[model samples]
Target: MVNPLDHPLFARVSHYINLINFLVLVPTGFLIHFPYTGAPINLVRNLHFIFMYSFLINGFVRFYWSLFSKHKDLVSGFLWNKHDLKTFWPQIKYYLFIGKQPNNPNKYNPLQKTAYLSFPVLALLQAATGFILYKPEKFGGVVSALGGMSAVRGMHYLIMIIFLAIISVHVYLVFTEATEMFWLMFFGKTEHKKGI
Candidate 1:
């Protein structure tokens, strides 16, 4: 049994590490600005920045590492295509309980591809706006381009909300739609009747 040349093992390892950053960043983003948190705003800001760095570093590293990976599927699976669009209808029907699940699914379904691919993009947008909000004077041009510091803040906040919502759905789908997925992601293997 020859294993597929492109294993997702390393990419999967990087993925869980990347998810940890969001887990902390989302809460801190709200807690820092929450009127009732009663905690020092700077403390929450510092915590949020820490996770931001981790997220950026992990994302950058995974992207660069994927370039040299033998297992290209790990990197390529996030790309959306015509096939993904074709597959999307059945996935929608499956979610609505009107279609049977796809038996031999690709590395991801269309919705998963869309969600996973959007994370880094949204993160980068959030990061750029965050930095601008962090030092408006330094990014005065960007602040003005985005309308103003308040607008930048609103964009950053909106990105956070979207990230949290997508992540919540992602987690629920991974656990419920196929519990084997969780184990496969964690252990990098599963007992399939045939090949992965």
Candidate 2:
């Protein structure tokens, strides 16, 4: 049987890469933010840039896959409709332990789609801010538009905190509410209930 939760190999691989990139970027980014006297600051910055590029590339691949792959319908969850708006409250209540889960048979519910869709925008903001910090001369116009270096730095740090919060909630839900999803993301397929 064709498992609805089964991801294509390319999708799974991109996800893995993105996960690893996130795992590396967060710590290295922190280290860069709060540098110590003995810390290898250059190394941390290098790793941060490397993984940041990997994350961006992986995001582009996922975007391309969404556009060209056979699973366009599945990837198009980022585009929502009136039904999604109607179900949003129910989904929120379910996550908050106040109501039953929404009975959607697709891979991602409206809430999940909403959360997943925000990542790319967050990533782009992170990338732009990072590049501005990395090469202030190159992004002088952007920095000025964003209210100078200090403001850009603040925005970048704030965005990172947002990423942390979202990732924490996502991980919690995956482990507690959808353990199979964790496996499915890594292995590309999962044995789960009909709705997944």
Candidate 3:
């Protein structure tokens, strides 16, 4: 039997774009927020904005793919449901090496589905606060609504750090899995883990 992940245009392409976007945006954003004097502040700020725009555009593409991709196998696959949350603990145990993997769900495990769905929500929070913080005067209403600039800045920084932490764990998990996992993301072919 063929692996369901054999298709080139499946999960890999969108993930590649997302990883690249985050790789560029996250560093530039961090530098801009806590700038080093090595480069002109204006230059860093410009770079941050450039990457920020790219991040938003990339988000749009991801959203489009989630909703309309031709591979309809699990287009909304990441959206969480009750069963996902209920079965989340076993997956956690599996990850921690105390239990077995879920009984080979269609694509993502329950935990995977919940975790994957959250990034876009985080992106929206980051972008909204980023816009208000970018120009407090222009978005004065937003600034006040968010309980002033300090709160907006706080939330923006918080999300950045949280994503960084999540990405760290994500990378570790990906590499710890079989080599096929890496190729799955790059070439869209995962030699199925028997009973995965």
Candidate 4:
């Protein structure tokens, strides 16, 4: 039998590229902001720009592929609906140990959809603020439009903290509630078994 977890090739490629993007950004971001311990700001800035372009290209490619590809269901899964909202409370209760697993066999659990939905918006904010701070002259329009460099910096920092928190929770949930799902993301190729 074909593995239900066997995702489309584009999805797999997108996932791998996304992982690479994260790896590249994390260190680059650290070095760019924190010049402590003799870190070279110039080198970090270069690496950050390189990775940022890679990320942008990957994202654009994925967007184009999704628009034209047959596996549109995967993309549609991220969209929120009334049912997702209705199930949100139950999903929370289940995660918090106050209720049982939800009965629906959704493409994405309500909570999962909610989290995934925030990623694109947060990523855009991170990139937009980074660009404004990186070249205040070129992005002076954006910086001035946002009130100034300091405001952009503050927003960037706030978004970074929020991103980190979301990542932490995502990691925890992957190991705790979705260990099997996590495995499927990497090696497993079986359809998601119900009633787990």
Candidate 5:
């Protein structure tokens, strides 16, 4: 069977969506980190709110499609397994220059699996905190549960930083390891190879 990663179009779409999310959400999220001062603050705040809702909706649709669509296996591969944990250290070593390559080249590397697992958790934290901060009155229960507006805001800021760091590493790895694969995400084509 052909590996799905070899499909350029799929890779391109994945890369494109991630880039879109980063471009639209990151800057506005950063601005929301600081205290607002003027009319521009209102504009930024509006954009932030709009993007947050957009992201939430986009994420839900993606999740639903992944779970129920034909590509469910792709999503399943991202889930943690004992084998992933076993290879985690070797994968780290490979990335750190101690090893030439990972022992197993499944759909995703151990690091990728770990990162994928964390993405949803971090996104949830960000969304939860963002909602709490967005409407301290309406979401007052959540805000209080999270220890007030200040605490929720602080967590939201921290999660944003973490999200950015993950994106930076993800982008770097995508470019360095497989530029062609990255291009596939946008163009949606993959090179053909003979049976294994």
Candidate 6:
């Protein structure tokens, strides 16, 4: 029997585009937040906005693809449910190296589902705060609603930290639990065991 495709080419391409855009966005954003030494703040700010748009557009593409693609079941599985509750602990233990990998029919385990679903929300927050910071005059209402510019800046920085943490764990799990999946995601094909 043939194994099903874990990630379609469109999904794979979108994944890399988001990854690349994120990789650029973080450093540029950081520089914008904390500048030093003839940093050419204008140039960095422009780069950050450019990559931010790219990331958002890629995210939109992935969302659209997930809704209408043959693998739409993945979106349905994105939510938490009683079944996910039951499997959550086992999945955690598997990650902690204290238990076997839980048998999950879906491509993602409970933890993965939760983390993956959160990206869009976090991305939107990051973008909102970013825009507010970028144009305080125009977004004065938003800035005030979010408790002033300081709060908006703090939120944008905090969201960046959260993204860093999530990406770190994601990369760790990919290398530790299912190395081949990373290759499959990147190259769109790889020989691997059925479950992984």
Predictions: Cα RMSD each: 4.4, 3.7, 4.3, 4.3, 4.6, 3.6
Output the worst ten-in-a-row residue range by lDDT, candidate 6. Answer: 1-10
Off by over 4 Å in 6: 1-4, 73-77, 97-100, 192-196
* lDDT tens per residue, model 5, 20-54: 77687778776766656663777787887776776
Q: How do the residues 1-196 of candidate 6 rate in per-residue lDDT, one tens digit apiece?
A: 1133767778788888988998899999889878999999999999999999999998887887788877765457687777788899999998888999878876678998989999999999999888888889998777888899899989998999999999999999888877777768876556465554
Per-residue alpha-carbon lDDT of candidate 3 for residues 28-147, written as tens digits (9 for 90 to 100): 777777876685778777767777777777777767766776754335466666667767898899988999877745466776666667787898899888888877889988788888
Scored by lDDT, the top model is 6
Pairs of residues clashing in candidate 2: none
In model 4, what is the error at residue 151, expressed in angstroms?
Answer: 1.8
Q: Provide the lowest-lDDT 10-residue window in model 2.
A: 187-196
lDDT of candidate 3 at residue 103, scale 0 to 100: 70
TM-score per candidate, chains pooled: 0.82, 0.88, 0.82, 0.83, 0.82, 0.88
**Rank ordering of all candidates by lDDT, starting from the highest:** 6, 2, 1, 4, 3, 5
- Where model 2 places Cα greater than 4 Å from the true spot, the runs are 1-5, 73-76, 189-196
C-alpha lDDT values of all predictions = 0.77, 0.83, 0.73, 0.76, 0.70, 0.84
lDDT of 2 at 164: 86
Q: Clashes in model 3: which pairs?
A: none
- Clash pairs, candidate 1, are 6-71
Give the per-residue Cα lDDT of candidate 3 at 187: 56
Off by over 4 Å in 5: 1-15, 35-39, 190-196
Candidate achieving higher TM-score, 4 or 5? 4
Off by over 4 Å in 1: 1-8, 35-38, 74-76, 98-105, 187-196
What is the lDDT for 192 in model 5? 30
